[model samples]
Target chain A: MKLYDRVRVINDGYEGYGIKKGDEGHILNAEIRYGTFCFYREDPETLADDASASVRIEDLELVEDGGATDEDILEELPRHNPEWGCKVIDGFIYNLKGERLNEYAYDYHHRRIK
Target chain B: MKNLEALYGKVTDYLKYGDGWVRRENISPKDIDVCNGEATDDSDTRTCALCVALNRTVFKNDNKPDYTHPYCKCEQIPTAPPEPTLDFPMRKITDYLFVKKRGLMYSMGYSEEDAKEVYQMIATNAKEQFKQGKYFLNALDNHGQKVNILLAFPGKREKEGHVYWIKTGWTVYPNGKLHQNTPFGGWAK
Candidate 1:
């Protein structure tokens, strides 16, 4: 599954992560890691959500494709919190309202910073 | 504290220089959630301490790595020392199995009274098995240092007679400490 693709958990082995079979979530990203296809979860929002697990591609089944765009989600953030804003003073750095983020934390396309 | 000293070496070595080792909060890019197909603050869960004057400091040698928060990004600078082989302590093992995941243990046919025996059975074998590289990689947090190793030990549940009870989550720190994040995920198919 690719990023933004909605998918269902086809595996019940993730009970420790509070994820069970039939639960659905959005695919934040996907890539080959440690020689296996894995995806990240972004839905089933909850306050207690703090950890992200490396889900194998086979464990998930696509529910929908190309559901939401970044701008669609960005437009919703300021409505929820007014302090939220992006200031790129330097090389693709996204700083928070109160934090001084100078070093590049991510790429322009959200590719993880190595 | 002694365990940390044993793992990291003497604190006075760094203290003599006066620029002692401080555990800086190491935030991995994986901890930051991506939104809108790009990195955004909308889903970031990290809470920055507003005061900004440096919250706390631990000696480089002391090596008091924070274990309280699962998502804690505390890191020791100038290259974290290597952890000795088999750093999974019994206290951490039992904490994950008994307290953090007690309910799941019950669901897997273990009782409150069986906590000690259950851990004794699992922990002893887990350490030995881990030494022999008998675990599977279930998942990994971003940056890849923090990983989830899947481990299974035999247990007899009430409904499911003999089973390979899977303990699917563990994390590796920059200092090379192995921590159990989740003990009971379910049984292997």
Candidate 2:
């Protein structure tokens, strides 16, 4: 399945791998490792920040086909609030526009990369 | 803790259907975290992955052990018949699928007749044949010819008793050539 295809958790696999049964979301990224496809759920905060729910390919069943227009994907992605600050190349600090080093630390930390 | 107990129960139940079912085994504390049920690999819940893998490979001598935790509540569950299986709302294969499966089987080098027999073999052993990946499986034809089959488990509808939705089929040879229209999904496959 390509990106933006909707997926639903079909079973309670192990610890649910972060997504519970009936949890539905668009697939942001998918990669096959160790003989299985690991899916990342959709959520975007800032550049380099990935917000996603991890699920096994086995536990997920394709829901909607991914024929999303570029506009659709861009809309689904978490947009950068102009006030949040610029994207940081370094891993630690983000949000320089505000007085704090990381006004959105919680959001950045919660980003599910890969 | 309840989930862990449930997981243990599920494993033992599947064990009952195993062939030449040997003695049941328990995972040790060292292999898995006794305190938190955390996998060393940083996965949130690999114990469940182990459970599925065990259900698939338990009959083999190489089946690995899995521990829910050191204080695993399931360690004391009785091992014997009166086996309790988790009730899943299963789905039955519709007759319409037979027509679709025919083409899937022939794509894997099965003669029309051979495809019919292989189709039944796959349907009957659905659980064993189903693997979580890019929707493909390895099976033998009537002549024991190794073949690959592509099956999809669409999330749109849950086929209660049904495992893989065998909508696509293919075949594989000993040399590892996948003879299906779809490409294998993995590193450089």
- The candidate scoring highest on lDDT is 1
What tens digits encode model 1's per-residue C-alpha lDDT throughout B1-189?
A: 756754344344355433434433434333221111122222253523210111122223333322333344444454332321333334333433444344556665776677677656655655555444444544332322233334554444673665554544444332233444334434445
Listed per candidate, the RMSD to the true structure in angstroms reads 15.9, 17.7
Q: Write down the worst ten-residue block by lDDT for model 1 chain B.
A: B50-59
lDDT of 1 by residue, A1-114 (tens): 343455677887777765677877544322223212223343343211123555555566777664333343233332233233332223332323333233343233333333
Which candidate wins on TM-score? 1
Cα-based lDDT at residue A44, candidate 1: 45
Q: Write the per-residue lDDT of candidate 2 for residues A8-114, one digit (tens) a residue.
A: 66777634335456766545422222222324332222111111334545566677665543333232222312223222223222232322233333333333332
Q: In model 2, how well does chain A match by TM-score?
A: 0.40
Docking quality band of candidate 2, CAPRI definitions: incorrect
TM-score for all predictions? 0.32, 0.23
Model 2 lDDT per residue over B10-117, tens place: 577557544222222234222221211112321343333332222212222112133244433233222222111111111111221222233333334444444345
Clash count per candidate: 1, 10
